[model samples]
Target: MIVGVVSDTHDDQEAVAKAARLLLEQGAELVLHLGDIVAPFTLRRFSREGVKRLIAVYGNNCGERLGLLRTAESLGYEIHDWPHVVELAGRRIVMVHGKGPAGETRELVEALARSGRYDAVLYGHTHEVDVRRVGSTLVLNPGEACGCLTGRRTAAILDTETMEARVLEL
Candidate 1:
């Protein structure tokens, strides 16, 4: 299965639209938003035809949690707290928003990747793209889709069959 990973959208409608299109073009059947979605309208941009499921976790910046949750439910999507875990394509995956100080978040992400409990750990918050393997697990942060920081809007495509992923500029 092809899974699309995005993080820190920060309410950029255009970037989110482009990213959604790009992910569908890349044959992504599932889409995961790590966090910083910000608004319900911006979150709706990810509701595309090709994506079978959309799951998101709460970021520190997500103040309108109730609205976001309502919208997600209306769209048949899911909104969860941070560090949510699920099995997909026969692999255990943990998703988090990467809250806390920058260094601490990075350390936590790496720790989760190295803990040997999950096949993949997805996170965002630093607004920096990180895709690497820690031991046997895949750890990825698709960067900031809003392009507010780093001036680069990015997303990621993960191929579950091969356990490979790539960050793409959007």
Candidate 2:
């Protein structure tokens, strides 16, 4: 399965729509967002624009900007409060906002890797697109949809079967 990964949207409706549209056009079957959408409608917009099977986790800014659990539930989106884990297409995916200690976070992810529990760990908060393999697991951060401050908007596409990731500039 090919899944589109994105993060730190920060309310750029246009960019979000464009990214969703493009990914859909590219034949992405699912969309996974790491953090910082800043509004519930962003996900709705992506769904409206053509993305199916949307999954997301919250950012530090999500409390006030995004919908509550019930709202997200109604929208057919699984909104992870924080530190969530899900399995898809035979690959285990763990997602967090990555706001705490990088060393500890990496250690925890590495531990998970040791268990062969996941295929990837996705995070957002640094606004940097990164993909690396930690032993058998892939650690990824799609980073900053509109470049909030850095002007570097990007997204990632992961092929679950191949465990390959492709980064795209929006």
Candidate 3:
């Protein structure tokens, strides 16, 4: 299964649409947003046709929490809580915004990735794209989808079968 990973989309509608289009074109069955989605309208980009699911978590900047939830509910989507765990294609994929106590440190994140607790640890906060391996787990961050801080908008496509991640620049 090919899953799309996105994060830190600080309400850049164009960037979000672009990333979603690319991911859908690339045959992404499911799309996961790591957070910082800002507004509910921005979340609509992930609801593109052909995408099976659009799941998200709140980031530090998601001020309109109620509106966000309402928008998602109206759209038949789900916004999970932090450190959301999802099973895709038989892989234990963990999604988080990389905030709070569980993901504040690189060491802690690495430890979680290497703890044999999950197959993939997906997060975003630093606005940098990274794909690394710790023990048997895959640690992936799709960077800033809005390019707000990094000046480079990006996302990633992860293949559950091979555990390979391909970063996409938008």
Candidate 4:
């Protein structure tokens, strides 16, 4: 199964739309957003035809939590708080925004990957692309889809069968 990973969209509709299209073209069956969506309108951009599901977590900048939840529910999407754990394609995965008052930093993300509790740990906050393996787990941060900080809009495609991921420039 191919899973698309994205993060820190930060309300860039153009980037979000492009990212979604690119992921779908890459044959992504599901798309995961690590958060910082910013607003409900930005969340709607994932409503593309080919995506089977869109799951997102709350980031530090997602102040309008209620609105995000409502929009997600209406779109038949799934939105959760930080550290959301789920199993996809028979692989255990944990998704987090990797920031906020809880101080979920890069260390925390690495720790989760090293713990061997999950097959992949996906996070974003620093808006930097990071893809590596810790023991038997994969730790990935798809960078900033908004291109606000890195000046490069990007996303990622993860192959569950091989447990490999590649960053794609949007």
- Stretches of candidate 4 off by over 4 Å are 48-52, 100-104
| lDDT (Cα, tens digit) per residue for candidate 4, span 61-156 | 999999999999989898999899979889999998976433458879878988999999999998999999999999999999999997999999
Task: Give TM-scores for every candidate, taking all chains together and pairing residue i with residue i.
Answer: 0.96, 0.88, 0.92, 0.95
TM-score of 3: 0.92
lDDT of 2: 0.78
Question: Which portions of model 3 miss their true places by more than 4 Å?
Answer: 48-52, 100-105
Off by over 4 Å in 1: 48-52
- The residue pairs that clash in candidate 3, if any, are none
| Candidate that scores best on TM-score | 1
**Tens-digit lDDT track of model 2 for 99-120:** 6655655566567656777788
lDDT of 3 by residue, 23-107 (tens): 9988898888898998988866667534457889989899999999998887877887778899988999888887655336455
Tell how far residue 127 is off in model 3, in angstroms: 0.3
**Displacement of the residue 143 alpha carbon in candidate 4, Å:** 0.4
Question: Could you give candidate 1's per-residue lDDT for residues 51-160 as a string of tens digits?
Answer: 45899999999999999999999888999998999788999999999777889899999889989999999999999999999999999999999899899999999998
What's the distance in Å from true for residue 154, model 1? 0.3
Candidate 1 local Cα displacement, residue 49, angstroms: 7.1
The weakest ten consecutive residues by lDDT in model 4 span 98-107
As a TM-score, model 1 comes out at 0.96
